[model samples]
Target: MSSSSRASPVKWGIVVIIVSLAAYYAVYVLPRGELGQAEQWRVLQAVEYDHRASSVTAEPKLLQNAAGSDLSALGLPTGQKTSPFTWILLNSDSGDDYGPIKMLPQGQSFTISCREIDDVSAKVVIEPAVSAYLKSHCVR
Candidate 1:
């Protein structure tokens, strides 16, 4: 076995390792510039509201009132007469896209917390009712 041939595989392996590390950092470790703090907060709040609203059969007025107060305290205005429940479903892999769960009333906003569970899935923590609603209507 020639020294040059032996060295070739090592060099390729090192290059592959470097590229893999770079991709990992780019995809997971690096902060997403696309989602600013305010946007993230909104997404989170929306999910929480949805989860909380879903748990109870009655109207989610208390949950909505609390959420509105929280938002107001945070200096974000809650629009008038909006639904008490909001849904936000975060894509585990992508930082760019999310939508409300189907069962949630449209235009309600809640909070969401997302952590990557693996390469393919994310652990999303939302409000209790929102989570229940999602489990019933959206969980796969």
Candidate 2:
């Protein structure tokens, strides 16, 4: 093959790789990373839970994005709310049987002993407002 033919393949390969990466970032990374998109996902996934809800639990950290800024800290309605119930609703994967959150002592780590079936779970101490919200909304 001529030198230009060899270089043509290499250039095309670079173009394909660049396009693939850009498409991945636009379709996957952008939606998951942006605040508005993340919030939308959170909302769509949300299910109500109350004290009576099964297998629910809360933790001090945002389980979805442990290292990222939490909603509560960001000053959103759900932010800073003790929302183990909401967390449970949000965090459960498809096919995971989730239950109500077990209450925790203030500032203590939360746990999910309430789960009647196998699941990956954790806990966090929730604020009163979060608990109240769950209690009120989860029942309906």
Candidate 3:
């Protein structure tokens, strides 16, 4: 066969290899499930809490009240700050079993106890406004 004819087979082989690899990733690797979904959520919460605590110490005026204090005394209308980081807590579980806690600064670190509410759902509370930022930037 001529060199040009041999090149066609090589190109076709490369195409097949690329297609097979794409199929393997899409069918096997991608669907195996998020390996660190739970861990990732925990880390996100911890980071947000830590950031909030630090922010409170750095800028005392930002944190108005403790988380679980009187909501009325808490800052209202949720003003946006100049900080690049923010945190938010998302209730993935159903029902309103837990008490509503006061809003903390984006820098406070807190220990969150996990409680069962329902099957296939749970709450992942991130401090400040990280959830919004993540949703906007991370999600496609």
Winning model by TM-score: 2
Across residues 44-101, which tens digit of lDDT does each residue of candidate 3 receive? 4554454533332221122222243211111111233433234333322211112122
Q: Is 2 or 3 the stronger prediction by lDDT? A: 2
Best lDDT among the predictions, by candidate number: 1
Ranking by TM-score: 2, 1, 3
Clashes in candidate 1: how many? 21
Provide the lowest-lDDT 10-residue window in model 3: 112-121
Query: What's the count of clashing pairs in each model shown?
Result: 21, 18, 16
Q: How would you encode candidate 2's per-residue C-alpha lDDT over 47-118 as one tens digit per residue? A: 222221333323222343322324221111222234433233233122211122222222333232223111
In order, the Cα lDDT scores of the candidates are 0.38, 0.35, 0.34
What is candidate 3's CA lDDT for residue 75? Answer: 19
Task: Choose 1 or 2, whichever is better by TM-score.
Answer: 2
Runs of candidate 1 exceeding 4 Å displacement: 8-17, 20-24, 27-29, 35-45, 48-79, 83-140
Q: After superposition, how far is residue 12 of candidate 1 from its true place, in Å?
A: 5.7
lDDT of 1 by residue, 56-108 (tens): 32222222222443321111112323443443332222233233232234454
